[model samples]
Target: MPTRRRTLLLIAAALGLPRAGAAPEGGYRFQRGLMGTRFMVTCYHEEGELVGKAVAAAFAEADRINEAASDYIADSELLSIGKVPPGTPVRVSPLLFGLLEEAWAQAEKTGGLFDPTVGPLTRLWRESRRRKALPDAATLAKAKAAIGWKKLVLDPAESTATFTVPDMRLDLGGIAKGQAADRMLAILGKHGVPCSSVTAGGDVRMGDPPPGKEGWNIGVRNRDVDRNAAELVLRNKAVSTSGDLRQFIEIGGVRYSHIVDPATGLGLTRPVSATIIAVNAATSDALATACCIADRETGRKLAAAQGAEVFLAEG
Candidate 1:
């Protein structure tokens, strides 16, 4: 929504030569614009035609998820849920249901620090950034009143979602990309390409090592792109970074990040960046956001509790 902030994490091509038994076509990299950002899938396969099809399938899956989860889309499934009256159960696709379940679980885990129901506040923040002004107290209170993890109920048995309060909305900006990346990687694996990586905006999900390489090289960029970046070698894992580095606005000389704090009903005032590494992108993506909302010590504990690692920097 905010011009798709440049990802703090960058992928560096592995330096190793192709190993024995590797595909003769070497590797393939495909890119498509989706979900307000560039979605890329890099894979190794025996047949070039298969690789193209696989990438197309993966991008199609991303488009499906975006149409369902995107808040910016006028007719998105997410918006449809808000159109119904309070207490009405809205049947959702299994994919949307699964993503809501993950987001809900993370919200509970973070004690509401990472909430998908903060759509009201997000809307206000987006407008605030555009106008370079903060919302009035009354308006801010109204938006905050409509946000709470408990207000939205997910019924897995029925694959339905119910809202207990009026004017409630859903925003999956934090976790949808990760879920899409995970699904894309799975799709690639199904196409006989077990060694692959999917980058959806800031979320990166990778499977297996590239040919002979031990792992993919991921470079975590600093606030100053001119500075040296920290790199990590990882495989069969996922990493995500959330921060105010690029997506921020200055109002009345105060810097406001795009990430909203549910407790305050406003964008975070501090300069913070959080990168999380976990078994999958969904976990890492949600954790990275929660990490940014918390202090460094609490952020580390939050990641640790989820069996993830956090690299948090605050100023």
Candidate 2:
């Protein structure tokens, strides 16, 4: 709710030529560096004159997706829903609907561990960090009360989102990356263009890398290394990573992760990181977030339930 914000990261695209076995189809490659994060977009066809136009078109889609899910912005659709009273019909695009619906399912499957209604909690952390402080148990508990998916009433009939708890807020930054990838894939296909991919920071959605190529090559990344770097391999699938290795703050020599566990209003310490591969980006994204908050068993169960291939890195 409150429209989504950049509590998440940000993007663009520059396509590469066919390297040996890369996809056969050719297109214009564009790079985008907007949002807080950077990524690239590549299409199957274009002309020197159309280069600028194609870049604009691809990023226009990214911009729309970002606006819908960013918490930093105040007028995003997600934010609009937070302000609306329960049961009010709100028109939403198919991509947003799918993202929210999947987010709802993942939250239930994870037993609130992956709840999207944590805008208030994340906002607290953002403020707490800025204030050079952390939330006390009392404050955290109160914030936890404001978090839960059941409190949301979503109606497909009218595409309405209702909040059962007035204080409850939804945050899609954690899952919107996948939705964006899915939408981009659709848009690319609609144009009958082939051989390309889109990457937003760590989340990447790739097609048959120009034809003849096996698939999208990816590296699960060692966060200990440079963040901008990743390994390369063919993995015709969506992959995501979550860990306490990075994005943490040190207090008294103890590191606290940025990824919060909705179950306890804190973050998980064990299982340093989790990398999951799934057919859909949203499932992998949601599961990665969920696994970060769950124990090994719980994570395993949920991963299987989601039909995701999960590899847990023991700490």
Candidate No. with top TM-score? 1
User: How do the residues 1-315 of candidate 2 rate in per-residue lDDT, one tens digit apiece?
Assistant: 111111101111223211111222444444455456665665444333343344455556777878777777888777777776654556777656767898898788878878889888887766655665678888888888877888887788877677776666778767777767666765665555545576666567766565555666677753454553345554446777777675676554555676777766764545367777777777787788777777778888989987887766665
Give the alpha carbon lDDT tens digit for every residue of 27-46 in model 1.
76666677878777778765
On a 0 to 100 scale, what is the lDDT of residue 87 in model 2?
47
Q: What overall lDDT, based on C-alpha atoms, would model 2 receive against the true structure?
A: 0.66
For each candidate, what is the lDDT?
Answer: 0.84, 0.66
lDDT minimum window of 10 residues, candidate 2? 2-11
Deviation from native of the Cα of residue 314 in model 2, angstroms: 3.4
Instruction: Give all TM-scores, in the order shown.
Output: 0.91, 0.81
Which stretches of model 2 miss by more than 4 angstroms? Answer: 1-28, 43-55, 84-95, 226-232
**Model 1 residue pairs with clashes:** none
